[model samples]
Target: LPTSSSSEDFHESSSSESSDGTSGTPTLEPVPSPVPEPLCWEM
Candidate 1:
């Protein structure tokens, strides 16, 4: 299903972004976004 594919894509994107964020950016960008995740129901 496309929704599954999109979820996979989103996960990959998150992994990539997290890796980049580890380089120097605020780790908070990833680690503390629990509140925003459910709020964004878009694909």
Candidate 2:
């Protein structure tokens, strides 16, 4: 579900970028990575 939400957000940003066609090499920030919890050592 979180991944879907992030993808939806990305789509929205691209649509906005379309409006400014001549921005000349628009730079985008890196997407935030999800941090995984540490696995149990004694599992």
Candidate 3:
């Protein structure tokens, strides 16, 4: 966890933000990519 914490710190360094509304990073929702339909064979 410590390593992860350090990595998070590094990320924070690269990123400008604070726990308090400082970052203003947009909250983006994940959108699913369209999947191709499988081919159907007639019996």
Alpha-carbon lDDT, every model: 0.67, 0.54, 0.48
Candidate no. 2 TM-score: 0.33
Cα error of candidate 2 at position 21, Å? 14
TM-score of 3: 0.34
Measured with C-alpha atoms, the lDDT of residue 25 in candidate 2 is 34
> Model 1 — which ten-residue stretch has the worst lDDT?
23-32
lDDT for 1 (candidate 3): 100
Off by over 4 Å in 3: 17-43
| Clash totals in order | 0, 0, 0
Which rank order by lDDT, best down to worst?
Answer: 1, 2, 3
Question: Worst 10-residue stretch by lDDT in candidate 3?
Answer: 27-36
TM-score of each: 0.36, 0.33, 0.34
Q: How accurate is candidate 3 locally (lDDT)?
A: 0.48
Model 2, span 1-43: residue lDDT tens: 9999999998868756754774423333222222222233334
